[model samples]
Target: MSTSIEELLRFEEERPPDGEAERQGWLRPVLRILAGAVAIVAVALVALRTVGLQVSIPVLAAGALAVLGVRRVTAALSPPPPPAGGGRIGGGEEEGLYNWGARDALNAAVKRWETPLDWSASRPERFASTVLPRLAELADERLRQRHGTTRESDPARARELLGERLTAFLDNPPRRPPSPRDLAVIVAELEKI
Candidate 1:
């Protein structure tokens, strides 16, 4: 089943009540930091006992300072947690149907080709209107860039370079999309031009 863009954007998950997540407060983090600092000081004091009390005391102080510095740096670098409310997760503009992600936009464009191809098979005029002009313009541009002349400027030479199939395709787009092999041949001829 096809999914609507609105459905995809809406948050469907169940969330806790507001203020529940924040109620734990800063007490946990402060206690954790203190415990870590004490542990570091204890380890340093034990490790450097043979160096005498003077050196050991200084080492313990340095260890405590290093632990606190690292904790502070990590806290500063990390992003704040999302608010307790069931608000948007990302701290950016809300994405709408038109503001598609890169992959989604590409997929939508690619999928859209099938509709035109189906129309072309039933109505040649539709193909002529939608696809022929673009192809002709591309051919003209390529010819002009390579030979310093457009298809209209030198029709005879352009016809020879573009080949009969592409020339016919541009003159009149097919009722149905060309096969993969035919397309490859057309592309090869266009590259030669």
Candidate 2:
């Protein structure tokens, strides 16, 4: 016999009925209901006495029994309590749903570029020393992967693939690095390879 992939991946949860919980403690509910009814009757009697009306003790006892009966009926009609293990803050993901402290979620490659890019923004030497070599390596890797040759290995085809502007930019590093917009354009062109 063969099982379908959907059937293999499907998850089913089976839980037994919770009728035992209601039967577990009969005394607690009776006492709690009795206490609540007594408190309610005491308050009602106090209110009636303050307003200059006298209610007999037997009438108050009857009223407490009525309250207890109503409470029992309502408890029977109300929904059962929820499953034992829910109502959590997170969506039950790994670790936690929130990062309470100072958490920076940057990709590894992008994070690696941050320091060099920051330094390069102020100084041409920093651009040459820090950021330029990484860009060159990335360009060369893409060229090699797609065309079987790096920029150094085949300058002619590299220049052809890299447009005139990109080729020129790579060949001669500017005294001052290009603006972020121009650098982004260069990176976009490199990605096309």
Candidate 3:
């Protein structure tokens, strides 16, 4: 009984009457401005009185009212909100169909890694500074997922699990980045972890 009552009250907010916004377009912003201005005046007057200051309340009110007016004007210039009936993305049926996943961000991440890797191939120090850290993180993540211990926590066991070549590669900063074939082999080993 209580669940049904709760569900009934959980309905979406009742939208404004159709054509009401068109008929009284200026009413909402005007009311907001009046309310903000009154609030500012009241606060300024009370604060001045409390501090025993004789600052002109009208001046304070005017400044605040101007700021509020600017805000309203800027908001009016900006893009309006989406349409009433749940917009395109908020369909009652399929959820993921309308949603645009972060395709650009995913592409950007690939480029971010690719750029560093490319740079490291020519400049060995770039491997230490940029690429090696990412590789180490991948290794640590795999180790943690498979063995429940990071390299820092169990270095001896981590070396055993990662094997001598891979462990040595990770332990010291390389004088030069590995060839693409070598890097592919290293990646395959990491995946096996």
For all candidates in order, the CA lDDT equals 0.70, 0.77, 0.80
lDDT of 3 by residue, 44-126 (tens): 88888999887787788788889898886566555445457855655632665443442344455568778745644677777
- Report the Cα lDDT for residue 185, model 2: 92
Off by over 4 Å in 1: 1-125
Cα lDDT tens digits for candidate 1, 99-180: 2232343355557876657533466566567666767888999988887877789888888878888888887666676665
For every candidate, C-alpha RMSD to the true structure in Å: 19.3, 24.7, 21.3
Q: What is the TM-score of each predicted model, taking all chains together?
A: 0.36, 0.40, 0.40
Q: Which model scores highest in lDDT?
A: 3
TM-score of 2: 0.40
Regions more than 4 Å wrong, model 3: 1-117
What is residue 45's positional error in candidate 2, in angstroms? 58
**Candidate 2 residue-wise lDDT at 59:** 91
lDDT of 2 by residue, 85-192 (tens): 744455443656633332333434467667555755578788888778888898899888888888889999999988898888888988898898889898898888
